[model samples]
Target: MKKLYFLIFTFSFLGYITEAQQLLRGPYQQKKTPNSMNIRWRTADSLDAKVYYGTDLNNLNLTATVSTLENDHDVELKNLSPYTKYFYKIESGGNVLSGPDTAHWFRTAPVAGTVQPIRVWATGDFGKGNDGQRLTRDAYLNYSKDKETDVWIWLGDNAYQDGADSDYQAKVFEQYYAYGDIFKFMHFYPSPGNHDYNSVCGIPCQQDPRQHKGPYYSIITAPQQGEAGGEPSTLENYYSFDYGNAHFISLNSELGSPTAAYDWIGAYTNGASTSPMIQWLKDDLSKNTQPWVIAYWHQPPYTKGSHDSDLFYEIYMKAIREKITPILEQYGVDLVVNGHSHAFERSYLLKGLTGTAATFNAQTNVVNGTSGKESLGEAYIKYTDGTKPNEGTVYVVCGNSGSDVAANKALFYNGSPHPAMFYWDGGTGVCGSFIIDIDGNKLTGRYLTSNNVVKDEFTIKKQSVTGIKNINSITSSISDAKVFPNPFAKNATLSFTLSKPMALNIELFSTDGKMSRVLSNSSFNEGEHSIEINSDALHLSKGEYIVKINEGKSASFERLFKVD
Candidate 1:
């Protein structure tokens, strides 16, 4: 009787262990577009999958109306809202799994030219199971907690050892879930890496069917021809979209060539330049007047890290120089963000090939000076005079999300072939992320360490648009002005040009039309005089404020901003 009891007890204990091991959660992968977001997870056995979501976390009144999809471990929830947050959960079988029950949240991106900031968390090579990975995850979560992050950009090599689904769950998902609350919110935007392709070599027993797809996909963030909000592709791995004052073009670095991605980008860029998207971006920028045009992909155009500037990938870079970057520059593009290197590095406003020197002449300056509502001219201007022109595109390498083995410390130094503004070895911990604040004409970026420290910081100012007062060339006694850093935090500088010197008065008012402070009351010179306004002294909070600048009765420009 005692022997039989012992056998039963052992069997029951083993069964419980198996069931506990099978529980699925953590490491949510890939959410795209305006309306719908997809959720991919795993379970130990065949079980019913359901997601409970709503605007209110306490009262998740809205559940996935459709029947739960069974058998498959991955599930996608569709028909969501743009720029709205939804709380969700996953259930296995009929039981609401408790361990993985942490509420997952996602915010849809606004349509093109909406003027809202498009926030993304980017990191690369972060699949190793180490302290660095944990630090990266923690920092990402900390930022997400404070900011409204629309998506998480994974530059590649998301899982180490092998890219098998199981390894992804163990190393990537489980390790991520170690901090369940922080990551439950943002959805992942992933790219492929060399290690991800090595599943065949490392995982003998496991065969992932998605290998052929290479985990490559594209997402559009606005309403489109075939779909309502936007859609994700299962076809070719690359696609493009227009989102809130920018045209986002994502490519497949591992599978496709520059030729294919270039053609696709050309069509999209040309269309955006002429289509309603252009007007929207223009209006968005006009209202917000944020000084940044941004783009992201898995590979870096310039890097001093483990992967030297890839000449093969340079073909794509050249294409961008010829087609895409020109358009962005024409539209006053401020930044281009990328990851692939296993460290964080930032570049100066660079132009041309490495080691090229050139001069800045009048014609060159005029050509580069062309701003808002102009066509991005031919490539000759960018690569002319044997030097690369700074059309104000700052390339950044933020691939140090978690995975850092064989990291190159030399890349961080000034003597490197491609010098970066900053670099970090794996010793400091693996994961780190960047936060960008786009307030009016200035774009400020903060690089946070794994422990939530601001490791590096930089700011890019928007170039003042010239020739606005050239309208006076056609009409005498005309009026115009400009205010910068519209979303002024502590202070903002306002500058304007006049046909002739005139006395000017500037009044800053709250959104409710209450006068807050007077920026300038003295008569100023005519060329271009900047007046600084201190916001904090006015005792105002973050919201839209109006700036009315008046020069006698003939000149004025009304601008608005959300103070931070």
Candidate 2:
């Protein structure tokens, strides 16, 4: 009888083991650096947490095991290879929960300041858990099928109604799982909006950001220690990161003063704020060496979409415009993206207009007055040289990803679109998202509607020609001269064909016209000739530089982009 009882108990335990723990939240990725990654998930029950990962799906040779048995799993895989693809699977209680399939893989970030093509998908107010949300996601997936998305940026209101954990579970995480494998693959950087703040500090949300804690704070794992680059902010509400040849700043407009009893202006005031966030911003910007700088947050400095920036009650928008924009411009920030308005709106290259929409003067504020469309031969060009300091910044309002914007017309000041906006949806009933593609010195942004139609597109190109004096004076001898890798790392090969044996002088200069290096000062043969430009010998930094090849009477200027 004892043997029979023991056999029955063993069978019961084996049956229980066969049942798997269900995943509740995410298998999402965060804080992705070239050498490290953070993966988090939630299960229905407490169980031993483990992540099996490797470069090959068939052979997951590495295991990151957690000692504690908990429902929430947060695993950090460190000392990883840069720009490598790794396949992984989640396991709990010794049972495989997710997968080691093709869908369960992530590409690590490349070395910072590497000049590589990167694609970013950005959307705002997309946590509705409705058909609109599903369609918008589907459109991005369909459009980006051929290309892998490197980064996903959220423009707040990630969850609808309220920013509760339950709302995020239903509308954000579960919805991504239901729609596609976005959470499983792409890593995201998020900024909180007023709706997200509502769940953190209640309605009319006002609280010390230093002491703030809630679902939004707990769910995200941003880099607060400068591991991914930039000076450490030590605050999750706002931080900075460097990827490839670009720098990204994620700011929080929902934060409030740490000292004040009830003041909600956290990031900055009309001029400067007592808040530390502004100080951190200055420090981060001053330390940034990347050529392309893009900053994003919740409230826009200029918009006429779902929200009116002209209203005095719109304090958040006003503060960003009057207080924050001057600082960004001072640092030569290329782009500022925001989402509080529910319609798509894009501004011309602008600067020095801090007042209301009525105070906007095109003659004084508009930098590049032409439409920034490359096909129209009006692509905005920014020179890194001191010749064009604070050229301009392009502002975008892309908050209609999942939310309806029918009520935007009611808030438009004087029932007219803000004059600052060069392009806007203007209530065409278009629901969509945007994409940013960066390659070398050029960046192109496109707005794609739910139907996968390209509605608006613009391009920004960074060029350097400061030291090229009298470049158009003459032309001779030099033919088919070009840099094999214009945007290169380590070393670059400069090849040219000379019409005759002539003395050549090659020199490199920084964007500010400072001499960087004297590459060649000798005569080349008449036929094809090549010279290797080494980064080590030149001590090159990641930025734009001009190379001048002088042949006595004729000179040729070529731009070179050096990456670390």
Candidate 3:
């Protein structure tokens, strides 16, 4: 009877062990790096964790790089190659040493500063468990298949309903794993969102211990050097890095008001705009200069979605306007990418309020001759000095990567008045994503829907700085000429700047060396004069067109432009 009792007790103990193992099947978090990747998963009881990785999914070679930590279930796989692909799986030992046996793959980035077009997938507020999210992911996968992007930027709101590990797994991880091969290769750079802070039901909560702390961090890699490439701050929150020709700054939006993170941002922004970082950026631009400077964060400066535009976080917006936007403008930052509102909107070439004032204040001339030549509407300009014309910064609201809980139609209509480039109600089109191509002197941005339709397009040209010339030095007798608005648009207000008053011949030529239109051969004065040239009459395309200002046997200047 004693032996029988002993056997029965052993059986009960084994049953308890099985139940514990079942409870720990999930809750895995992984982060990728240029040379290696790290993964952490939990189990109810202590066990040896191991990972198997190889080039082939069906046959993974067991890694002796095994590490065992007490209660710490994280594993790091290192010594990866740049721009290469590999497969991996995780396993733990129990009563029978069972197998998860599931395989996954990833690719590392190419060497930094390599002369290749770097493509990145960017989106935010995409954690809804619905068709919108699925469509966005599928579109990205298709693009990745075509482009082979180097990195993926998660602008925040990664997992709605509180940034819990389970929510991330169900909404983010599972959805992305649909294209696991592409993801296995690309590094995911993420920032924190308000929803990530567990701020639901108006309750303030402490950080969840299941995942990495605050979620603000940076990473550096090869083809990029020194201070610019790596994550310098806490792995869980706040970091900065440089890639190719751009300096990417990511911030934590859910952290404390006026916390250490704020101070860090000020220091980094100030230093990067001035010293080594700026020099690096300038040098990169001088060589294979990308005309677009981009930065991403979870929350947006402007949004009309679930959050009202008036409900904008004032303090944060103020921080961006004062400390951030100036540095961006000083360094010629052309684009700011964000995700929070769940729809897409693009603004005109804008200077945030501060930059607008500075730019206008620096300008010594203004052309207010015609109504059309007046400042680009009141909404586009913020006259801080109350003297100069308005020059405002552009803000894009692109958040609809997933299903919408509700529609915010008003958000689509309100904009900076230059022209509403593109707007979409969340319920209509397939979720929105954009691709920006910076090649040589021109930058083109394309907005694509889930079905891969090019919904909207725009291009910005590189501005050339010309040296000032003296009017007295020219032998070419200046004549009847006019270039309106001096710095014209679809058409320029033409005027003559002649050395000696004479009859002038004005003609517009396409960049292809083709003459499109002839303005006048009328007689004029030696001083400043004016005339109007209808750019539409020339039928010139949007690019550098030569405007020949010819007088008798003298000279001229080729003024350029946009004909749209």
Top-lDDT structure, candidate number: 2
Model 3 lDDT per residue over 29-103, tens place: 244445665654455667667767776777776463344543435666778776567666666663322222332
Residue-level error in angstroms, candidate 3, position 233:
4.6
The clash tally of candidate 2 reads: 0
Residues 312-392, candidate 2, lDDT per residue (tens digit)?
778777878777888899899998888878878889888888999999987567766556787765677686653344478
Task: Please give the CA lDDT of all the candidate structures.
Answer: 0.50, 0.79, 0.50
Ranking by TM-score: 2, 3, 1
The TM-score of candidate 1 is: 0.59
Q: Higher-lDDT candidate among 2 and 3? A: 2
lDDT of 2 at 248: 92
Give the local distance difference test score of model 3.
Answer: 0.50
